[model samples]
Target: MSKCIQGLSLGVLCLVLVSTISGALSHEGSVALSHEGVGRKQNVTYDGRSLIIDGRRELFFSGSIHYPRSTPDMWPDLIAKAKEGGINVISTYVFWNAHEPVEGKFNFKGRYNLVKFIKLIQKQGLYVILRIGPFIEAEWNHGGFPYWLREKPGIIFRTDNQPFKYYMKRYAKMIVNMMNKNELFAPQGGPIILTQIENEYNNVQQVFKERGADYVQWAGNMALKLNTGVPWIMCKQKDAPGAVINTCNGRNCGDTFTGPNSPNKPSLWTENWTAQYRVLGDPPSQRPAEDLAFAVARWFSKHGTLVNYYMYHGGTNFGRTTSSFVTTRYYDEAPLDEYGLVREPKWGHLRDLHRALKLSRKALLWGTHSNYSLGHQLEARVYQNSEKNVCSAFLANNNTREAATIYFQNVPYYLPPRSISILPDCKTVVFNTKKVNAQHNARTFHHVKDFSKGMRWKMFKDSIPNTEDTPVQNSLLLEHYNATKDTTDFLWYTTNIDVGSNDLPLLNSIKPILQVASWGHAVHGFVNDLYVGSSHGDHVQSPFSLNKPITLKPGKNKISLLSMTTGFPNSGGYMEHKIAGVSKVLIQGLMTGTQDLINNIWGHQVGLLGEKLEVYNPRSSKKVKWVDAKGHDHEPLIWYKQ
Candidate 1:
């Protein structure tokens, strides 16, 4: 029998179910987490069912918390809050670009100190998952690979090429040696229970044909050679070789993803995307707390053993680390916001889910799993543990629009539409995915005292290139990347087109259509100091195009086309070949004929004058005038900083 203790709005309620099962847990549904500190070795293994930690079959609730995403000062609060939120495993990607921005040069200081980050998690008694992807495409720039790597001679990324393999081996070995010296592996009792290599490479391997399969095998072998003494995983890699476990990554991996490829490996969901990352100019996304809980329950119901939320904290994308069109704020509607603040309901609801799952972990890990159809669109997934004389069960309702009532173990239980109820003892209805008992908290932002009294700001205008300055002249407009070398986002292509008084209509037309094609992501056109037009496109989408009718004087007319980039793509087929700047220029819609301007004598400028003058640095020694910018045009081509 069930009793309703309190009622809430919107059909929410609190329940207490009377227990009748004689078989209960040994410790009465309490979780004991005791792994912490360093200098202790552990024997970690896995089976088709779950991970065996020190000979004990275990299930984990994991979350991703990128260390470089935030500073060291914020690590404590973020990690402590995560521990308090019931996350036992803290996963992170060791960004290669952040560690080794240049070839043969390395850095591991401040936020990039991976050792310090792992130690902090150990201090909190949580396990760590080191995803040393070298090519992590978590909306990270260049997919976390160093820009210098792209310049290597005859090197193909993520393939079986010798140049690529040599460098990959060196980097991977360096990381392994570092971890080994520090004794960070679980066998060394340092909280790092598992490590991953070569992220999501399987997504693009099919294009490589047989070479792709060979590369996969080689990568797996190389990673396994490191001997981290813990199981290695490859997310989204279906053809993962040997003992390396292939995991799943997606929004909902329960119904869509099958079990792991190998029967001896347990089902692992490495990246359960809480919500999609926000793109620039797009509104924030929200994944309903109820739906997230339902997905979690569904995964566990389908015999999933270890689950990791892609981003539990989803911190801010500091500096220029964001990839492509993604925003600097990568909060992604996670349980923890960009500033490490706890999001209501998501944080609390997931915490409750973790606790309830831990309660039944013993049964789920060790007991035999089976499914039975209870009724229409309803099923019961039961875990029977005859060894301990205790069992657990999940009552799931697959119906989308209606609640379900099903009889299980001679008891009639109510399941809400598309939800699951957990019975830790097969009798007591302990928790339900649809029932959120935690306090629904709402927060308010309040400004501090003396908000804007002493605020002083200076701005600088990024001026266009004048005719007096000698630009880098080239017979052919250089490719954007080769010209700028990734130093700046702006590239200017300036040219002077002569129009005679007695010329044809195509050359002297008053309002001719000046067209430019494929300028990376965005472009701005100017004809003789007047802004003609601008155009933009997503970098991953089609090439950009700018077509504007221009009023050119019947003489030497200066045309300046400024090309802009969002950020380099971190993931895609042949992303290295992506380029910016206009390849073809044309002036059409004339009575005579069209005029092609590709062969014109073009002058190129890598960046803006504001960039050259160091205007962003307030204390620079250069004597540059600062404009208040209070009444100036606030459109593009202006630099503002505080």
Candidate 2:
């Protein structure tokens, strides 16, 4: 290895190691890695230690990068950066909604092109790990489920329901066949080596009892039937079938994870959460680089031969792909930030750590390992070949507050608190968990104004409910998710409130409060076409209400409420069953104490007229009468563009 692999944390194009496909070491129950897949066909088999490609065990450093989160032009740079960062394998989840937004309609163009993304990785002498979780809960909309899937007449999600299974199996087979047709699997001489079926089902399986467990078994079997000629895996799932490999997922799985359920499988850490995802209205969740290095070392020391960073680079969510409270900025504080820039000391520190792991390749795969302690709370893991010579060594200090000097092989070694020191030759300290040799490279974006294009504004007011559109009228208010199937965000709820002459006499002194109780993400209230108030919702109290003072005519007054949704629920077992829209409409502080308008004839308009006409774009702005918003600035329901 040269200076290029030393401190260069995700440098653009200096991956000297890309030219070779050499054997690297696996942990205790050993295996070793070979070259990337291409040209000639190869077999992928796994022993009790790690994945075997071309009859060799692989010590993998996998990086996650979802293709749909980025554009085609951005793939080469992102993949190259991952390769430069010492990642031999690329991991990604197949988002169902992005590919099949409408029933019988599929899209694989532009950003949703999975085939192009995988090929780009193969072109760089790297392997691919396709996690085809049609129900992936990546904080993605509807948890990567197709919009039409939730609309099926008799359907229950993630259970032993025939309707759900029918669709899930259909989609999974479709993906596998697509990969097979493209010859992407390793057995077909392509880059893909491993494929994953169900994502973290164990977390929510208890909610459904026996049905969830049955579904888990069925899912594993269904994936095995695909026969991609590679092994299948299920993460966060316990009691997995014999054909599937059960892997660990968490920030630290070294101490808690007890390998795979079966003896024939290896210890694999699928998701090493680099850092938690940043949520809306909150600061970026962070995990220190040193601590991350410590965790990786611990996992390897504990016999985990394969490990993957949940997000080596968490790209942009873009558009309305975000779910729950997760921000559109999907930067997970990872090695590569949202913009694909190397995240300073973090990227550099991990790169050096990978280099050290690669250097210990042969010893870790074939040598006998002996575990011993240097002192109290200090331990050493040493691997030796047939000659009994120490080839790979690791010194770890488990203390969080106290530093220690441990003597290994009769030589003194200093370790920082909560750190790991790697000595590949048992004498030279190549890398330390606490050391950061990479320089910090912060990204700066410049917003320059084009003075030539003068500021001219195009404005339009959004249409109110029931003016020109048809609505679904019912005696009871309908759940927005069920009513619209998430076809639109703006759901118009219109109803009439009648106040008799006798009730006005007592209402002369007290003004009635218009309280619109909502179950939606947001609600905008209007009394007789006049905008009153609006209340937004978070992951917190979702049944939020909007109480505003109202002056209504004594007769029939139409109340129009616009219920909006940012995105649907992404987690939980029965998350698809959540209801959205107005639940109750009440007129309080009246002479009669309170009047219930809940059972009245309520009309629902699925979407807005402006949205239907595409008036937001310059080409379609001419279709509608755009109001000059020169004076009415900062007002609600007004669309403005420059």
* Candidate maximizing lDDT: 2
Clashes of each: 0, 2
TM-score of each: 0.91, 0.91
Query: Tens-digit lDDT track for model 2 on 358-425?
Result: 77766666666767666667777766574534366788889899988876654568889988898766
Ten consecutive residues with minimal summed lDDT in candidate 1? 4-13
Off by over 4 Å in 2: 1-37, 387-390, 450-454, 467-469, 500-510
Model 1: per-residue lDDT, tens digit, 1-642? 443221112222223333444645333332224653344677779988888778777778898999988889999899989988888889999888889887888999998999999988888778888998767899987788777776788888888788888988899889988998988998987888888989988788987788889999999988998879999989999988899999989878898787789889989999988887987777778787888899998898788978898799888787778887888888658998888888878899999888778778767877777776666677777776666665788888888899867666555788889889988887678778888887776667787756345655556767777544537876687788767766777888888888765443544436679989965778899888678889888734668688899876667888888987766778975655656677888887655468788888888888888878877666661468776756655555777655
| TM-score, prediction 1 | 0.91
- lDDT of every predicted structure (CA atoms): 0.80, 0.80
Q: What is the C-alpha RMSD of each candidate to the true structure, in Å?
A: 5.1, 7.0
Model 2's alpha-carbon lDDT is 0.80
